[model samples]
Target chain A: GQQVMQIPQYQHVQEGEDFTTYCNSSTTLSNIQWYKQRPGGHPVFLIQLVKSGEVKKQKRLTFQFGEAKKNSSLHITATQTTDVGTYFCAGPVGAGSYQLTFGKGTKLSVIP
Target chain B: SAVISQKPSRDICQRGTSLTIQCQVDSQVTMMFWYRQQPGQSLTLIATANQGSEATYESGFVIDKFPISRPNLTFSTLTVSNMSPEDSSIYLCSVELAGRYEQYFGPGTRLTVT
Candidate 1:
């Protein structure tokens, strides 16, 4: 079975500070997806990285996939209060598999 | 992305009781999955429900405890049987649309067993 691990289980930052969460998978993944879950809401799809060494950005959030496709990272520049939530990184159980194995996730708290 | 709706947003159940959670997708999908999330924990895969075949349970999750039925492509049901205090958690159903790798999750059912 494949496993995904995340670093910095919990993080608290000043309103204008930056934050980053790293994810590593026990096995190489075909693709990796990121999700955000608010305090009382369901997990929402954020972004998906398919190509190795790919980098994508959405507003202040930047996502990067390692060249080996076995790890990934999410960096938020200048976090705000609205950025408080848990970010989870998930990857397919196997090549072409629909089932995803999610990392423990990094809970972020932005202090205003 | 898919729009999923789950029934009984929240419920309180007694020990030994069973509660069935329904998941309805806005469109027909081929792959649907059930997940459990405890307080401040990551999402754990419970099972995979594909239309027309038996559900596949993950390691640590048994079919008898979390029975799932995919009667059609747009709907599925998960029943938590013989519940206990540990059974209390948020159950969510997600769908992976055909040809897409990303999955969309439902709002989830918040269940608390006494």
Candidate 2:
């Protein structure tokens, strides 16, 4: 079975500050996907990293995958109030598998 | 990304009752999954529904308690049987379109057993 762990279960930062959440897996992954869930909404797809050591950016959010493909990270530069939500990292159960195992997720609270 | 929708956005039911949640995808998809999210907790994989076959349940979940059905590529249902207080949570269904690794989730059905 594959397992994904995330650090800093909860984070509260002032608006304009930076935030980062790290995710580690017990086994190497073929690809990793990131999702965001608002206070009372369903999880929304954010981004997906496939290549090892790949780095992708969307506006103020940056996603990186480890060279070994066993870990990933999401960094938000200058967080805004709208950034309040839980960020989750998920990976396929195995190579070419469709089922995904998601990390516990990091809940971010932005204070203005 | 696909447009996913779920029926009965939220509901309150009595203990021992059963509720079925329906998921519909605007476009055809290859893979669909059901997840449960308890209060203040992360999402847990309940099962993976494959078209024209019995769903594959994850550890600790069984077909009796949470039966799933995927009659076609765009529709699925998950029924919570013999609900209890612990059964109260948000149930969400996600789908992976062909040739895509990312999965998109529905709005989710919030169930509360009284």
Residue pairs with clashing backbones, model 1? none
Index of the highest-TM-score prediction: 1
Give the lDDT of residue B71 in candidate 1.
Answer: 96
Proportion of native contacts in model 2? 0.81
True contacts kept of each: 0.90, 0.81
Worst ten in a row by lDDT for model 2 chain B: B95-104
Instruction: Report the lDDT tens digits of candidate 1 across residue range B1-114.
Output: 889999989999999999999999999999999999998999999999999999999999999999999999999999999999999999999999776789899999999999
Candidate 2 Cα lDDT to native: 0.95
lDDT of 1 at B53: 99
Per prediction, the TM-score for chain B is 0.98, 0.97
Best by DockQ: 1
lDDT: worst 10-residue window of model 2 chain A: A93-102
Candidate 1's displacement at residue B103, Å, is: 0.8
Let me know the DockQ for model 1: 0.92
Q: Against the true two-chain complex, what DockQ does each candidate achieve?
A: 0.92, 0.87
